[model samples]
Target: MDHIFFFYFAAVIAGTSVLVVALRNPVYSALALLIMFFHVAGLYVTLHAEFLAAVQIVVYAGAILVLYLFVVMLLSIRSEERYHNQLPVAGLLGVTLCTEVLLLLIQSRTAPAVPRGSAEAAAETGNTEMIGEALYSTYLFPFEVASLILLVAMIGAIILAKKDIIETTE
Candidate 1:
């Protein structure tokens, strides 16, 4: 039952991810990416990480996808008629990476599972609480840094939009 849901989500995620790269139109590509993000949130739900699933949907599918669509619309980009001639190189690299991943998967399946320690104990503490503790305690500096970066980006975007508005009015 779980396997079925997992496979379905995985298949959609894989297909949409490919579409995200293969679609010629920027809007279509971003829409495909939005689908992929929803499927990823579904995957997180299946893993019992409900908080992560919510965050994935709200932060990625909600905010990030909206941001991407706004950028695509604002830029008014047109699709190019000719494709870049890097297909052969991309194909070769893809094949190499796929082979390496397959080998790693096979090796991991045969290896003995290591016993969990603090992580297992943390599981009893609830996902959201544990994440909160780590975010506030162990990872506070990195979390604050990420927030500061986002703040700067938001300010820069506002400034750019304001400049464009002023230019168009003048």
Candidate 2:
């Protein structure tokens, strides 16, 4: 059943997400995050959002995770034995968030479901097309801003790397 698949994906995603944060080793944490990403893509597939599923796999799991691993390897970061003192604060926030989520879930279950659009309308428009339209239309300015920010970041990274290379050669 759809519910079974949803629950399975949700459970894996939740577990892996926790593992991603709790793991001491950066590589292991990234790997856990990779598993979480795959499960998220699976969740999207279960929701009939094939394009989103593919994008999630390709963008987050493939590109972003690869970038994270590269940074981890290049930096050669060592795991610190001492833990941060923020555990109590984090625990309090976590408990508060869990309670809020539970309340929201309960409220949603009791609320009447409102149909935003008919299945025929969605089917005719297609998920990809709808997303593309919204991205290029309603969210055009924000999208462009994000792209600009990425461009600046890329250029800055290149400059910094070049300086390091020059210094090492000297």
Candidate 3:
């Protein structure tokens, strides 16, 4: 059943997201983040979002997760110094925001709207080829913008990895 699949995906996504937050080791956290992306891509597929799922896996899980792993590996220093994040105000603000969102969610549980699109759409135009056609034809500008963002991120990552040197003759 589609209902069962949705619940399965939602569970995986939520579980992986929580693991990403609770995992202390940077590498484990990155792995959890990748898992979260994968589960989210699965959810997109259930919703007839073929293009979104591809982008989620390719751009996020493939590119961004690799970048995060490289950063984590680079910062694998053996210093056991404990660091404290002194952000009491920011923490309180975040808690407050979460509580407000919880309240909003509870209030909306009484009357849920019918979901758009049918299961038929999920069967039709569900492959990478059709998704790419839609992206390049209908959403060309947004796709170009996303590519630009990825280009900038790649450049920034390279710059971050570069070592600066100074030479002097006395």
Clashes of 3: 0
- TM, every model: 0.83, 0.85, 0.69
Model 3 weakest lDDT span, ten residues long = 161-170
Q: What is the C-alpha lDDT profile of model 3 across 19-105, one tens digit per residue?
A: 876666778878988988998999998876778888899999998899788877888844324434755776799799999999999
- Residues 88-151 of candidate 2: C-alpha lDDT, one tens digit per residue: 9999999999999999999999899886766787788889999999999999999999999999
In model 2, which runs have C-alpha deviations exceeding 4 angstroms? 164-170
> What tens-digit string does per-residue lDDT give for candidate 1 at 79-157?
7666679989989999999999999999999899998666668568998997899899999999999999999998888
When summed lDDT is taken over every stretch of 10 residues in candidate 2, the lowest stretch is: 161-170
* Superior by TM-score: candidate 1 or candidate 2: 2
Model 3 ranges with Cα > 4 A deviation: 78-83, 87-91, 110-134, 164-170
Q: Look at candidate 1 and tell me the lDDT of residue 67.
A: 91
Rate residue 69 of model 1 by lDDT.
95
Query: Lowest-scoring 10 consecutive residues by lDDT in candidate 1?
Result: 115-124
Highest lDDT: give the candidate number: 2
Q: 2 or 3: which has the higher lDDT?
A: 2
Can you give the lDDT of residue 40 in candidate 2? 92
TM-score of 3: 0.69
Ranking by TM-score: 2, 1, 3
> Candidate 3: what lDDT?
0.81
